[model samples]
Target: MSPNYKFQGWMGLDKDAAKGKMVWQEYTPKPFEETDIDIQITHCGICGSDLHVLRSGWSASLYPVCVGHEIVGVAVRVGSKAEGGIRVGDRVGVGAQSSSCLKPDCEQCSGGAENYCQNHQTGTYSSKYPDGSKSYGGYADYWRGPSHFVFKIPDALPSDVAAPMLCAGITAFSPLKRLGAGPGKRVGIVGVGGLGHFGILAAKALEVDKLVALSRTSSKKADALEMGATDFIATDEDEDWAAKHANSLDIIICTVDSPKMPLAKYLRLLRVGGTFVQVGAPEDRLPPFNILPLLAKDLKIAGSSVGSPAEIREMLDLFAKKGVHTWNNNVPLKDANKAILDMDAGKARYRFVLVNEKHVSQVERNEARENKL
Candidate 1:
């Protein structure tokens, strides 16, 4: 394999790319180093971040971006100095991150908190590397990056289900695990969408005394219960729902990214000394938060991002052993444009995964397309 392989994928040339205007064109990946690995992408989960980058919603995005992070594939080439014990042909996964400063003096790296690395943090896409090359994402046939961020997917977990877990699942799982959501603890998951569903499953896996699923309407009540939630709270349909469940939960993980969420009411649902962690990223400022409720009850409001690679490994192991699954709607890689629009319109049952069936069908098909010809 050569470093000059023709990389091709759906590239967003400008902000209008968010409206399904991406162009499928051949491009070039960053020059590889001994610490890198090339993956033949089999599945890439569509995330809200993809849309954000395409439209520069979060910040000025690097144009011509290939937006996707939740990636799963088989390693096609492993660099001699690649970290993480990765070898050629190993099935691995990459999430939102591609690199972080691993220097010994870095607080986050040395403290096992790479997610919060302050010195240097490179996203899987829409960022620049130290060498002045732009980072691409998994929306392509292949992905190349440092092996330290790649993780081995457990065999028991299917690739499709495991793809979304790379981002959405870890985003929710980290907070639940951090907030002491285990046996004897009553937990509530706000919103019944992708991240919330994972919160419900993780809480159940942690053996929480009770798990309550909260949503605006009763439409997802049955689904939530099936996902291992011990109870359901329909905020819009049930009168005094907040008061009814007030001081009932020991920990609450809010997964709704909408800015208009009932912040005060959600806080009321927390028990004394209970914690409320927001894992969802809202585009707008959160609704006016009140300090009264927080001070009166000693409630804690915190935020979390996607977990570190170590945390992802732990989550995958637990999912494989406990049979954790995601309710996903699969689409072909060619339909990513349609999939993104559908996802923005809330058409997914829970999550969406783009499968590169054409690339994964045969070893010859994969091997014939080398990154370096």
Candidate 2:
């Protein structure tokens, strides 16, 4: 299928773009193949990773990068060989991942862990395809990618709400589900921001016995409680906060990436045999912590990336079934630069999703009307 539309979006030509300098420009997308699908983006969520990449915080980002992964849009072009039964005009989404080697011999791919596929895993933006073409993101008018990474959006979930779920929601959902979060388990979500908010929502949906939200201050206390957190910990206000909650939770999902975070104290909040999963990516190395506590309690520390296609599908179904709602502020796609800056300044209520006025569908418009009622 040939692309009949031009690809254009807000591109960060250099590091200064992180400081609200991104320019609106037309860009070229990767060569489309029979397995590819083209989407006219309606909404794209502003993720912390976008800011990180804009400034090359994690690594030197590719020049002229269009950075966004939490993308929801209408499928305008579907290749004949595309999978997932995607069709033209279907509401769909794409996440942080764009491609991975789907070889039969690859253990990760065969085992349903394609997100961890070591061979040829490609990010949605600032990444290159095997053909040496750059993969553009959803911060623009359109996005083209392999259909394997694209997903059909559920009718029950609004596009603005579902956009962040593609990345932030799945990032939290995968770890909790994998670590056995459910009725009998207690879960603690550290850092109540974009990813942490989803962690609280997912833990609540999983029916955890106790859900605790830990943050530096009590600013997000009400918001966390409204999101179904049973307990809120103000780390800055309470001196004995860690001691008070000692051995309380079975799983702790740390979503903040500060090297100076009280790592050892956070470990102490875990019960015996508890697991602490680190999903936040910090540019600097994590601070050294005492290993004796880990050894004493037999605690385990692990890391999780975004979920696989199967897991993403499972999460979407769960969101629809459980009626999970996201706390998000919508910004115009044209003001993406300002939105990114606000996101970096911690001004987002929880998550910020960019709305492309030109591409919003009737269904999304209807969803907005219903929400107002």
Candidate 3:
């Protein structure tokens, strides 16, 4: 395969890109390496990070960055020394991470925690590789990078639904599964959006005794029930919602990134020794809360980033085995700007996937043409 592939996608030149003004053009990918795989992108999910990068919301973003991480595609090329069991033509996916230093001495890498790999944790976009090449993302026609972060997509899940799981789904599923959200445990999923929806589906698949969906209003009640929630709580509508559901859930996954969320009241809904995990990355500092509630109930407040590759594989397997599927709205990759805007406005039913149908069809055509040639 030639490195002559002309990479192209929506590029954010400045903060104004957040206002739906990304320009599409050809871009260069990192130089080829023996440990790389070139994925012909079929779908990429629009995440909050894409919005943040377009506007430089989270620190300084690399300009002209193609920001997106939830990627699903077919491996068109695989390097000889690439790891991760990748093969040419395999349907695969990449998550928030693209590359990491895999040295055995590295604490994070050696321990099967590549997501926390301290030394060379490079994001899929707006990041630089060890070779000083810019790392592009899946919002493009092709993505070339290390295979360490890539995993095969299960046959049961569609590309659109599987795409968001690479980011939003795993973000919630990891903490929920890690905290033991299975039989005999009551779980609550706050925010009923992409991440929270996955939390509800994952909890149900894990066979939890009871699953609850928590949102500011009861607007999501029907959707939550469809996603397998056994109960729903409208925090704003009910006067004493917290008191009424006091000590009800063993685990709570907060998917809402809003800084102004009612913290103490949410804590009140937890049972003794219950754990509250915040998976959403709020830009602002969290609201201050008294420690009395935590101390009294022996409760825990924690935060989780995306899962490790091993963990992602485990989650994918679980989803396959339990028939867990995501509720996703598909938008053409060309309409990414509109999709992101809708995501920002909270319009998506749960998750959004940018389908690169043209790219996928082109790849298939090219493959057939090359064989004929």
Candidate 4:
């Protein structure tokens, strides 16, 4: 028998709601199916994407959307058709994606790059399923979605820290793992905040030859170096920063979401045949750039989204095995408005995870402690 629970949460009714005006109200969730699972959310990470979609900064969003994609919770109900062998009462998580076209004929899905599924790709928030039903996100008391996108949280990972890995961590990890950032590779992570922090950790776990952290100022130099970055570049501190670091990196993961970012200068830091990845989502269009750098160095510029379920599982195992830790701040669910405001004001030390107090316990909070890598 199905358990009865209220599908309610903080919902954004209009563009102005992004300013910490989200209202707590009951909302309709997608119709449940045999292939779906119900998670009683315990922790949800507040991401920049939530703020963007709340204000319709990316594109027009469906009103009353509850946005938080990095989710961690207990599986209260599991469908027999679920793909991951999930069971009730199991700790699990879901990322920015909820559903995708998983047909074998689809090249991207079949090729193990399901994150790039071109057909019927549904975001966890502000998106509609194939049946036209609204797919809500983790900012609610409960979440119902395709189990194929759900992943079992490793026992060694604390829910508070594991929550952010679903999105921010995977968004950074997917690119580095896919681009071969290890051993002989010299990698640079731009912006030492949410996504970039995880980028540095993942690269270090992969054992890169050199890890460089690029930021606007030297404020985060100590933190970045402690997070496995061997060198730190304060761009605003050095007017000749570009020339100083030219042709030094084989791979650069640019995580800043500004149109005015020094894109050309960043490209110059890449060695010949290097790859530059832009994982940040910007509200406005990026500035136009010269093609000379690309033409001269044979550089490759690409964009990466969150990882697939397989990749998510792989990341969890790697983090657990390496004893890696994320610098995270915990905010109660009721204080979501304040949390989002602080997040917008750039006050989060690294990442913010909303804790549903009624659902969390001391055991989960003190699950395991790893080195702050």
User: Can you write out model 4's per-residue Cα lDDT over 1-373, one digit (the tens) per residue?
Assistant: 5468888999999998899999999988888888999998999999999999999998999998999999999898888798888998789999999998999999988988889999979999999999999988888899999999999999889898999999999999999999998899999999999899999999999999999999999999999999999999999999999999899999999899898999999999999999999999898777778998999999999999999889999999999999778789999999999999999999988999999887776325434332232
Q: Which tens-of-lDDT digit does each residue in 331-363 have in candidate 2?
A: 999899899999999999889999998777554
**Model 1: colliding residue pairs:** 2-372, 5-371
Local error of candidate 2 at 210, Å? 0.5
Per-candidate count of clashing residue pairs (backbone under 3 Å): 2, 0, 0, 0
Q: Which ten residues in a row have the lowest lDDT in candidate 4?
A: 364-373
The candidate that wins on lDDT is: 2
lDDT of 1 by residue, 79-166 (tens): 8999888887788999998888989999888887798998888899998777878899988999988888999889898889999999
lDDT of each: 0.88, 0.93, 0.89, 0.92
Error of 2 at 157 (Å): 0.3
Candidate 1: stretches off by over 4 Å: 1-5, 363-373
Candidate 2 residue spans exceeding 4 A from truth: 361-373
Q: Cα miss at 10, model 1 (Å)? A: 0.9
Model 4, runs deviating above 4 Å:
362-373
| Range of the 10 consecutive residues with the lowest summed lDDT in candidate 1 | 363-372
lDDT of candidate 3 over 1-373, digit per residue (tens):
5765678988888988888888898898998888888998999988888888888887888888888899999998899999978898889999999888989999989998888888988899999999899988888898988888889999898788789899988898888878888989999999888888899988898899999999999989999999899999998998899999999989999988777899899999899999999988877888899999999999999999999999999999999888888898889988988888888898988778899989778767977998999
Worst 10 residues of 3 by lDDT: 1-10
TM-scores vs. true structure, each candidate? 0.95, 0.96, 0.95, 0.96
What TM-score does candidate 3 get on C-alpha atoms?
Answer: 0.95
